[model samples]
Target: MKHALIFRVVLGLILSSCLSSCGMAFRSEWKKAPVTSGVEGKWQGTWLSDENGHHGELRCVVAAPISRKLAVQKFFYHATWKTILSGSYEAMHTVQKQKDGTYTFKGEHKMPDWAGGLYHYEGTIKGDEFKANYKCAMDHGTYVMKRVR
Candidate 1:
């Protein structure tokens, strides 16, 4: 039993290391991605949980839409908790440009039931400000970011 527990711990560490390395590689690629007039760019900000008041640092890389007709933007996010634990995920949201010069977006991402099941996001981007509210079975929160220039 002791040997089995040790093996599991070691395996978990290896998997965590691999995932962290992948995130680092993606961050480098995001830095090289071009900035456009749309929401595509590097973003830095914080995520606040309205339910629990837990907040942390957040960073996102928004990829430009493949076509104007589709209007789907990919958001790659890295979030930290309590200054220690962290995770990364990708979400795609359909963006609609409004007459008032702001863009509204909504999307859903599926996560494990233990985590959140299905998470929904609704947000708006105006100029350099990106604000979004997220909801799920486990927690609901808001993301506030500014385009990195």
Candidate 2:
């Protein structure tokens, strides 16, 4: 049992280190991303849980779709809660451009079961405003952000 705990601790540290590194790289990319009509840029805002009233600061760096056929854009997000607990993760959303110069997207990201298992996101971007609703097995929330210019 003791050995298992030690192994888990070490694994957690390694994962945290990897995530931190990825966050830094995403931030660098965000700095160079150009502001466009599409949702490819840096965003800053807050996430609020409708289930518990918990809220926190949220930031995202959106990358352009790798393939036009797939329409999947990568979003790297760093979120903070309770003023201290923070982590970063990546999600891939299938974005569809609308006729009215807006975009809609939905995606799911799998996390460890203890964390939430799988998080589902549905959102839209309109004129520099990003709004999303997220739901997981443990919680549900809304994210509101504006393009960082």
Candidate 3:
């Protein structure tokens, strides 16, 4: 009788544990993904340093259109800074598309004998404006670029 009682208790505990753990699994409502934004154009904006709020004008042209395949996109990014530094660099990076229609990428910038460092960028497009957050080795900043042809 004692053995049967212990077995019942153990089974009850096991069932309760299983039921409790089932709730821990991820569960979310299914929703349609947003349309991908275009990143092909000439963009001009300002890079505001997060360290000291010092800003610089930045112009970039995404020479190629973002790839729309299932895999991450590889795009050509060329940019020039006017204030904090005066130079231009070209880089090709793979950017991922988010469900919210934004893009995120990480790459290194090397401008010959000029500045070089690692950077992570996240940007969103709305109408003709492109806003992005840049975090580099020395400083982090937000840039707002307007589509110019």
Candidate 4:
């Protein structure tokens, strides 16, 4: 009976220790922090295409209004290599601060034109810069933005 009791206690201690350590790691990995307000302004930059040699001038406006959502970004991009097709885009993302002080978010951008599919975005905000990977229909690229206003 004593051996069984001892074995049970040992097992309980092992499980408790393991669980406590796991909880600590989880808390550290998902530490909730404040959003950086510096990104709320205008940004101007360029985007380079990975498939073709196409490149373009980009203009973006960011706003962090007081609401349930964290931020909204509006972009006007014009890219030309053989032809010119420029479009204005916008997206809103829920912001979360990462462990490394950078912020990460995921959201969707809807095109204003007819029958245009929604483009999804996932990006990181660090200091005065924001970078995101965007995809819609058959188009995908990285948008690198710097605060200009």
TM-score of every candidate relative to the true structure? 0.83, 0.83, 0.53, 0.57
Judge candidate 3 at residue 38 and give its lDDT.
Answer: 66
Query: Candidate 3 — number of clashing residue pairs?
Result: 0
Q: After superposition, how far is residue 59 of candidate 3 from its true place, in Å?
A: 0.8
lDDT of 2 by residue, 1-149 (tens): 54564355346535764665766776677678777657998899999989768789999989889788999999888877667556678999999999998999999999776555799999999988999999998678999999988
lDDT for 30 (candidate 4) = 26
| Full candidate order by TM-score, most accurate first | 2, 1, 4, 3
Cand. 2 Cα-lDDT: 0.83
Off by over 4 Å in 4: 1-37, 66-85, 112-116
Best by TM-score: 2
| Candidate 1 error regions (>4 Å) | 1-22
Most accurate candidate by lDDT = 2
Ranking by lDDT: 2, 1, 4, 3
Instruction: For candidate 1, write residues 1-149 as lDDT tens digits.
Output: 54564354345435554665746855775679676666888888999989768789998888888567989888888877667666677888999999999999999998656555799999999999999999998679999998887
* lDDT for predicted candidate 4 compared with the true structure: 0.55
Q: List clashing residue pairs in candidate 4.
A: none
Candidate 4 Cα deviation (angstroms), residue 42: 1.5
What lDDT is obtained when candidate 3 is compared to the true structure? 0.51
lDDT tens digits, residues 65-102, model 4?
A: 44645444333332222223333434666667788889
- Judge candidate 4 at residue 44 and give its lDDT: 60
Give all candidates' CA lDDT scores: 0.80, 0.83, 0.51, 0.55
* Model 1 TM-score on a 0 to 1 scale: 0.83
- In Å, residue 86's CA in model 1 sits off its true spot by 1.3
